[model samples]
Target: MRFDDIDARMRVFETNHDHCVLPGLYIVARIDGRSFTRLTRERHPFEAPYDPRFRDLMLETVQHLMNCGFQAIYAYTQSDEISILFHPNESSFSRKERKFISILAGEASARFSLSLGDVAAFDARISLLPSQNLVIDYFRWRMEDASRNCLNGHCYWSLREEGISAGDATQQLKGMSNPQKHDLIFARGKNFNDLPSWQKRGSGVYWQEVSVSGVNPMTGQEKNTARRSLVTDIELPLGEPYEDLLASILLDGVANRSPILEDVK
Candidate 1:
């Protein structure tokens, strides 16, 4: 065998036996909302496949969590559900996982409601997992769900337009499995590259500020102020996958009050 393969096998073997170093708190957040589907259908009635706006909003929500003090916050979307990851040592928000989930859902719902002129709601569930394997399984389940939903029909159609078919896409995804589950989370280097350049650069989030001009909900009067805000671009550990970095930051935030660092050891 090649030296690299042998080394990789050795590392895997060591990781499999090491119990202490792998223990860290993991938060698996599932975000859901009916509004997303409704808005997607309404906005892209003829698209018959995907809505770029929906995807943009979801990414924005993920970015919001990352900026709000979550370390290693990585988000992946399938259907209307967004799976988010966080590392254990970071502590930028109190009730970190729950708060971010709630905030993300609320922001998505508000944006959709306001932009579409319809009522909407989003909800999320945060859970702690014991092992990285479980996290991997969770992502696999979501990916399978996305495939079953016709290759994330709402998201895949866009990929298909670019020549990626549903069946081939699903198989390609399955081939790129990761025990760490970080592979499953969306990253700027991977999935982000598939997006339009404007989105990759986060123009949609910024444009929301310029496009929205109306009465302020809280003030109940006409307002010229920008309502939408962009989350700061967080710097991640060098060479780390975006999802892993996001997870680290989020876990740090959650670990502030709870002593869960040992779990990731």
Candidate 2:
């Protein structure tokens, strides 16, 4: 009946469900906006398929996550979702799965809400990739998903513009082949291939070292400095090239990075 005894009894249930990601594996945390279909279409009404304003909001969330002491090597965002790849050796939060899921979801939701000037919620789940091949395949999959979504979106909106109801548009594209979708949109004067790469392949964010030279007023001397900053890739490659690109990043990301130095003249 004592307080300590009751606490011990409850603690058993709490620790029983604890799960941690195994070390020496790459961690990918994908956060998706919850009920964002309704939020975007019904409430906010953003441009279908893609929106610059919405993309910027998602990028801001990805930037915040990369800098949140998570040691994320790369981040990708598209269509109300963001996926971040963390370095293999990062041991944050003791590699607790729940910690990664809850914290990332909370951080993404908060950052996106701030940028949107309204409430936005996200749910996150971690995937432990065992090898570089899997990591490359994972991103390749997302990029392909982006392409599929982009095609479907443009087609649906095109039909809607022609006064086709949402349900009918969905039904129209339901059995359409890839080439058929392209032809359908092309007939309507839109080229799927000419659309922005970001729309088709999603956007990527990675760190790059920039060299800057500045003169000191007091010393009258020049100094070279290096700093690491996030670079957004709006025009990402597709197909095998995209996979090879991600494979290279996953293979030599930190090894090839230059040391950031700041020595004032």
Candidate 3:
């Protein structure tokens, strides 16, 4: 067989089932740390439940992903997972599902591992939302989940500090109501409401234009310029307000002007 014929024949196996996200749909990538429980608790001496160091590492990873060659509009991180909302018209890799999954997972894992000075892995899945409302609901879903995780984590760690066995702590919280869990932590002199908002609602990253004041070298005159930059928001709002925020980002003129999905395959 000719070289070109052989190359084409072999490429089919790799590309045969390649799936691309449909046009006009919203693409969100949910990337999660793999086996992070062992990685954080057993291997590393990270503080229990939540650690500022770990949180900073996660924030850096999110910031990296936002700028890593994709038109990511927003990103949310809580616990060991990060969810990214892409611009509706993103055309990277022809919007191929596998490409997004593999590259995002690889990038997150590599970035996080390098930052932590240890090997850590992450897996990613793409969610194809058909409407803007669904995109809002998707992030709302994650925010609520972060609330639950935050409550549960505080409760668990409080019990553990009192020398409760891991199995016993798990059993104790198994069927407890949210109010009951809050009471459990409150009894230990910690108010659930007083915990950091970032721990409860997760953090978000988005692009914003800021006015930068600079001196012009040629004219030696002060000037104000608009520059686009990423804003890491640890104090995210909740419920309807959060939904409104996502809607605003989606409706931003810059987001609307992003590149449309191209026919690259």
Candidate 4:
């Protein structure tokens, strides 16, 4: 076969199933570490349940994505997973799902691997939410998941400290209710409520606009320019309060002339 003919035939397989997200819908790309158990255990032995050191690495990855010339509005990270919210009008790479997934996963993998000083991999999936309410609920869903994980982690670690094997600790938490787990953790004299909010709610990253005073060297006059930057939110609210905050950010992201979710370049 001719070189051009062979090239065209092979390219079809790559693009045959390519799908693009619809316009006017919120785009959330979730990236999760692959085989993190073996990875962490074999090379990076991080603290069980939660670790700020690991959290900061993920935060660096999230910040890179937000500033990577995408119209990302918000980013949330918990455990070894990250969720990035993009504005409805995002048209990068023609909204191709595979492009977003591959690049994001690659970006996260690179960022994490660099921080950990070892190879790490992340896979990504995109979620398209049609309505504002659904978008709000989507974040709340992740937040609630973090809460449940926090409770279970505390219970399991408490048992492990008591000399229970990892398998036994897992089984114990599996049969316990939320209240039971809370009680079990409290019995260790470690109040789950006293834990850091980031441990329970995960961490959030969003763009903030600030005003900076600048003096024009040529004009000799002071001028104020609006600056955009990323802010890490650890003490995020839960339940309805979180919904309200997300709603405000969502509205602002899609609003006309809004500063959030703009191209960094």
Q: Cα miss at 264, model 1 (Å)?
A: 29
lDDT of 3 by residue, 147-233 (tens): 999999999999999999999999999999999998899999989888999999999988766667899999999999776667888
Q: List the residue pairs that clash in candidate 3.
A: none
Winner by TM-score: 3
Q: Write the per-residue lDDT of candidate 4 for residues 1-265, one digit (tens) a residue.
A: 8999999999999899999888887899999999998876567788887778888888888888887777888889888889999988989999999999999999889988898888899999999999999988888899889988888878887888889999988887787778788888888897888999999999888877766689999999999987666778989998888998898877777773235443331
Best by lDDT: 3
TM agreement with the true structure for every prediction? 0.44, 0.91, 0.95, 0.91
> After aligning candidate 2 to the native by TM-score, how far in Å is the CA of 93 from where it should be?
0.9
What's the CA error at residue 217 for candidate 3, in Å? 2.0
Per-residue lDDT of candidate 1, residues 1-265 (tens digit): 9999999988986456322212366766676876555555665453545356555555555555444434443445644566766554444454445455667667656754565466767787776777665765565566556544532332445445568776875565554434212333343133532433222221211101223457878979986743323333312112235336344434443444332111100
After superposition of all CA atoms, the RMSD between model 3 and the true structure is 4.4
Please, what is the whole-model Cα lDDT of each candidate in the order they appear?
A: 0.49, 0.84, 0.89, 0.85
Stretches off by above 4 angstroms in model 2 are 1-9, 215-218, 256-265
lDDT for position 153 in model 2: 90
Q: Rank the candidates by TM-score, best first.
A: 3, 4, 2, 1
